[model samples]
Target: MKVVIAPDSFKGSITATDAATAIAEGWASVDPAAEIVRRPMADGGEGTVDAFAAAVADAKRMPITVDGPAGASVRTSWLLLPPTEDAPAGTAVIDLASTSGIELMDRLRPWEADTTGFGQAIAAALEHGVSRLVLGIGSSASTDGGTGLLRALGARFLDDGGAPVAAGARGVLAIASVDMSGLRPPPETFVLTDVTNPLTGPRGTAAVFGPQKGLTEPSDIESVDDALLRLADLLGLDAQHPGTGAAGGVGGALVAWGARLTPGAQEVAELLDLAATIEGADVVVTGEGSYDGQSGDGKVPSFVAGLAASAGARAALVAGRITADADIGLFAGVASLTEIAGSAEAALAEPARHLRQAGAALARSLSD
Candidate 1:
């Protein structure tokens, strides 16, 4: 049987490549002659660069030092796509999450962090003469509405007193003016975002994602809202752009910088030629850290399943855990869903064993 294993990282447990390898190992055990193709996938989030590196032959690493979310210096890696006919110079794949990701901040003081480091990364990539920057905006901690990122990129935010205020959400409400004269020109930039929330309103950055960033009560919501409004007015942005609210309004900042926003998974899939691989496969398996309604919204797993269905191949999903009432039908090509046993903590404690078990079970089911 020709089987394809393509899975996203199981968050803190395993990487997408590791997940695919585990599944491939299981399929090999079931039938030594099985042709198992492993393709790691990401939704242009944390593991994006790594996934692309694994798939493309000309991808190389460039490590650069940038400011961390907490203003500390941190060294992060970005991917450089070798020069091609379309991109003779080269293209840079930058995962914004690497610098400003929530995982990089102290959860106890998430409100104090910023995305300045993310801008620093972009600046570094630009320094290399890379015209196209594929930025992945996901897993951010700050809700300052991307003011911090803009500040690092030469966009100045002045308080009502006509002075620079302290960085972070705490100072967002005090901004009275914005200056964007310092931004350097790049040929083109594309921001790959996973969410579609506006910059303000109930589904906005603060209202929908602030709580996750450590804002426990509704009392603090107004401050974030006010700050976002101030930013919107100063930048002449609609504040209701479809994905303006993503990654703490990083999308807003990118939009202001003339970036084209596209679905994260779709962009990555095209870059990796995922559909071509699924076309002749007899079966396809895809997964993530968790499976539920959210997965249907252009996530990696759902994108793979949809492609498999269009190619007349059956798809299956495996996740660390599955939501009880999730809309499984949303995955039109997915024939079955499997969940690894134990809680997230347990799975993380023994990732390899759990992955093997999950893979074995999946292999048996597919064979049956």
Candidate 2:
């Protein structure tokens, strides 16, 4: 029998790699002869770089320092994959959360935060001569329509005086024109995200994501949303394009700079060659920190289940917390920390141990 253990990071607890290890150990305890495969997964968020580092042989980490979301400095690293036939010079992988994510902020600077740090990292990667770029643009801290990122790449966001505007959403409101004459793009670029929102409108960036970044007031949301519309107009971006509203409109901005937007989970699945690994598996197990209704929308668990079903293998999902309406029908079996640990607090406090327990339980039930 063969079992593949692939899971995403349990946020605020264990990483994807550790989760996979713990599960595999438990599975081994039950079926020592079963072939086990461990694959850690991420959907273009915080753990993106680590995912590639673990899966790709000869991958290196390139360290750099850049501005943080709230005007501070942050030390982070991007991943460099060794040369391939498609990208002979190599490929650079960057996660926006490492440099410009809301997690880096002490307090939300909703309007003042920007994507400058993300842009700086990208610039550094370009300077290193990478032939292609893979950018994970999730967990952003601002809704500046990506003006700050464009600025770092030499695209000017000018005020009425033809001078550079301030960075962040405030800059978005002050922009008189946009200049892309000095912008530099790599041979190929992929912007990884799961969002499909428009650039600006009732369902756009500010309206949907601003509150999470501290822009809760109706006035604030309206102001930023309008500014994003202005930014789009000046950039000649289609506000209604799918994914244009991702990362506070960074998706649209990257599109303007010649980058393609891809569904993060599907993109990562291809990179990991998940389907090929599931072809002969008896059962495929996957997991995440939380399993909710939204998990069905391009999240790791749903993607894994789809691949397992295609390969004629039963799929089991294990998560830290599995909500009541999480579309449990997608998996043949489901295990959650809340049920195994008796409480959410206990589960979070000792996630690895509980994850192991869940794995053993799944193995026993599936083997029956």
Candidate 3:
């Protein structure tokens, strides 16, 4: 029997790499002779680089220290996929969650957070002469309309007196003009995200995502939204463009730099060559932290199930918590660590322990 295991990170509990390893262990324990394969997955968030590294044998981790969201030094590495015939120089995969994500902040610095680290990482990747850039814009810590990122890329955000403003949303609210003369040109950039919000207004980043980034006052959100509109006007780009508001306006910033927005799951699947990996498997297993109503809308499990359908294989799921709204019927077999552990707290406290149990149950379900 051949089994392919692919799972996204269990969020705060375990990483995709560790999850796959645990699942593979459980499967191997059940049928020691089974041919088990692993291909961890990510949707352009925290584990994107890890996914690429696991899938691509020639992928390299380029370590660099950059200024974090709160202007502190952050240690992180971006992935560099070795040169192929199509890309003579190679490709760089960077994820915002690692460099400029909320997890790095000890306290909410809504007005003080920025994306400088993300852009600095990108600048380093560009310096490596990569032919293409794949950026994952998720888990943002600021709502500065990408001003911090652009600043690192040589774009000057200035006030009416031609003086540079402070970093973070404070600077975004004071922006009067922008100078991109010294900005570096990026090669074929592709932004991976699922958000479709525009750059301003009620449905925009500042209005919709600002609260999560620590925006407390309604007036503060409004101020950031107004500044983003001004930035949009200065850049001569559409403020209402879909995905422009993703990652607290990092999506819009990349757009201004000539990048294309694509669905995170689909783009990541292609980058990891998921369809090719699951092609003739007898049992294909995939999972995530939670499976809810939104799971069908381009999550790892649904995409893996679709691929299994095309490959004529049975797909199973092992989620941390499966909600009532999730369409569990998509998978031939399903296991929830929460249910197996008898409580969500227990499941979370020891996710790997329950994950292995879930794996074994799913393996037995094949006979039932």
- Residue-pair clashes per prediction, in order, are 0, 0, 0
Superposition error at 281 for model 3 (Å): 1.1
lDDT of 1 by residue, 63-138 (tens): 9888888877888988899887767778899887788887777554546778888888888788888857888888
Query: What's the distance in Å from true for residue 222, model 3?
Result: 1.9
Model 3 local distance difference test score: 0.89
**Tens-digit lDDT track for model 2 on 254-366?**
99999999999889889878889888999999999999999999988998899999999999999999998889898888899989999999999999999989989998999
Worst 10 residues of 1 by lDDT: 330-339
Per-residue lDDT of candidate 3, residues 233-266 (tens digit): 9988799999999999989999998999998888
**Better-scoring candidate (TM-score), 1 or 2:** 2
